[model samples]
Target: CATGSAAVRQGIRAIDANAARIVLVVGAEQMTTTSGPEIGKNLLKASYLPEEGDTPAGFAGVFGQIAQAYFQRYGDQSDALAMIAAKNHRNGVDNPYAQMRKDFGYEFCRHESEKNPFVAGPLKRTDCSLVSDGAAALVLADTATALKMRRAVAFRANEHVQDFLPMSKRDILAFEGCEQAWNQALNKAGVTLDDLSFVETHDCFTIAELIEYEAMGLAKPGEGAKLALDGETAKDGRLPVNPSGGLKAKGHPIGATGVSMHVLSAMQLVGEAGGIQVPGAKLGGIFNMGGAAVANYVSILDRIR
Candidate 1:
């Protein structure tokens, strides 16, 4: 932590001093079976070089721990994440662009069958995100250049925020960085939560989507869980969320997630989305996080073109 922090601090200072216009930060993680294990080995190598056996478990194998702490602290009901999965699956069933198009119910996920296995304590094979190899890009243009491009999708607002590295260091119930990013995006979009007809967030796990309601200010602090239970986040709900099937069902392509979020949201606005289209979506939100909420990016997009 000390070493990495020092480098980041130095980088930020240099950029600020040089009058850099913008910074497009992305986390492109494409760890295959061999790569996943290798990353685990690398984390262990970096931290416990002298004592290899004492290193932390595989980094890819840690979402469950975060989910466990999340549900424990946030107070979830009936693994509400299942509803999020359902939403994504149903959406994917129609998304020709989606990685997973088959629809699976919560019943099967709750009761582990031949396929689904428990990854972390409470997170199941079906509950976790998929290791998809994909890419997403963001064209961060200055206000004038972005407006002049005319051929490009303008990133009206690209806000970045951060949280504690370790889950124990911050509140697991809600994403503080998400809230900050949300505020910045909405402000840049010149709208409020109500103005957005739909949203796309990093549903790496169902729990992340639940907290997004609060972070995005779509739901009250702890009441965001009800959005899932009440069908409010459904495709035709009052405020639909993750209409693109999300990382859980659509597949989590780390490098491409942020850009994908914008692309999916843009589809909704333009009415090009095959089956996951929202009725009259004009404004949308795309929220992406890296490394268990370590870094956050919130983008607000509209159909001005």
Candidate 2:
């Protein structure tokens, strides 16, 4: 999952250096073999040592804490988070490859119930991504090689930016690394956010998506919630995000999530996405993050074949 974007970068480098005409990038994760608690414990290892593991809620707890902090700083946006979850779930219904395809409406996602109880802090069950078992792969080639192929998508810009590892070392809500990656990638591509017709972003948690709105300049900090509430990130909105339902609905199979995002975004650019297709999609953006935004990768892609 974390290496997915980096793997693509390596592939691009390999082709650019003339070391290889093509490169195969793949990622897989088999997470369902373990119980939910066990998975939570494993995910907790991603956080800072000692304290994170001791937290009763595991990964969700960490993100839940982030959500709480954001709310405290900028009003409660649980409604916005629910809207994000509902939007992704609704989009997921059109994705046959998605793990959870059911469209759990906004009401079910927003309010807590016996089935949709809070996992940690304000983060409800629907706010978290699924523990999925899956694999995704892609083939990358040089421009010359791709031009000869029947179908091909080119990477307009691929940039990566890393932040401090410890959550306490930096402002968790700012996601500065994420913001930098987006700005650098777009600048390198000679385009702006509006040039992208759609995007496939890392939504390991619904809160991540909300904050990413601000990180990617879609909204000002502390106001990302308004983007969801106003439906700016909806499928038919100005810049449709996660048209494939995102990790929220498509399932976040650690290793596969990044690869799946690129695949879905490329599909949209090429008109190969049957159900979740965004008409007239010429440019696509992909953001994949690892470890609480510590490692961020952004890719701008467009179909050339």
Candidate 3:
């Protein structure tokens, strides 16, 4: 997940030190080949819950619990979560590489039906990212060499932040590590959230996007729901988030997730995103996380050529 971006950032730094002229980074995953129950069991390994425990829902279950806790602390925001899901699904319609490009409208996403069932507590099937198989790659070169290249996207700032792995060790609602990574990247890049043209954020679950809105300084804690309800993260909104449909619609192939974010963000910045391009996009931001926001990575990128 977050390792894809972190590794690319390190490669870029190594190139700057003259370790190499060109660096190629690739990430891929194949999760759909496995059986559903086995996949669920394997993903549960990432959770702090003991493997032998009575809990059986896997990561979806863990995130659903987080959603429940958030609901308890703030207020029921099922509508807001639904809005995020619908928005991303709609956005995926324009993304050619998206795994689930079909447009599932708000009504379909908001309410549970025979087609859209509950996966775990509070979280519906629409709220979860799909099991997918995908890969993405990037070629990074020195500034001088990149100048001669056909296209150039420079990393303005890339930051990584780590938090406690155990869910019990920290506040599940805060996503403090995500906030810290965004702050550090923005500061290092000498820009604010408003400076970016668009963003491709990790939306492993719709609730994650809701929490990320607050973590990225778009809204105060407990107010992120308002952003989605008001359509702020919509494609035509003030600042489009996850214009590539995010992990929810675009697909979450584990290792490929972060790389996919970078690839799509770069496409937007260079006007190569085709139907999904954010008009006149010049700068793009990407946020990818591993585990439950334990490993966080943020990269601010700008078109240079």
| Candidate rank order under lDDT | 2, 3, 1
Model 2 bad stretches (over 4 Å) = none
Best by TM-score: 2
TM-score for model 1? 0.78
- Model 1: weakest 10-residue lDDT segment is 1-10
Instruction: Give the local distance difference test score of model 3.
Output: 0.90
Full-model lDDT for every candidate: 0.67, 0.91, 0.90
Ten consecutive residues with minimal summed lDDT in candidate 2? Answer: 44-53
Cα TM-score of candidate 2: 0.98
Residue 233: error of model 2 in Å?
0.6
Listed in order, each prediction's TM-score against the native is: 0.78, 0.98, 0.97
Candidate 3 worst ten-residue window by lDDT? 47-56
144: Cα error in model 2, Å: 0.1
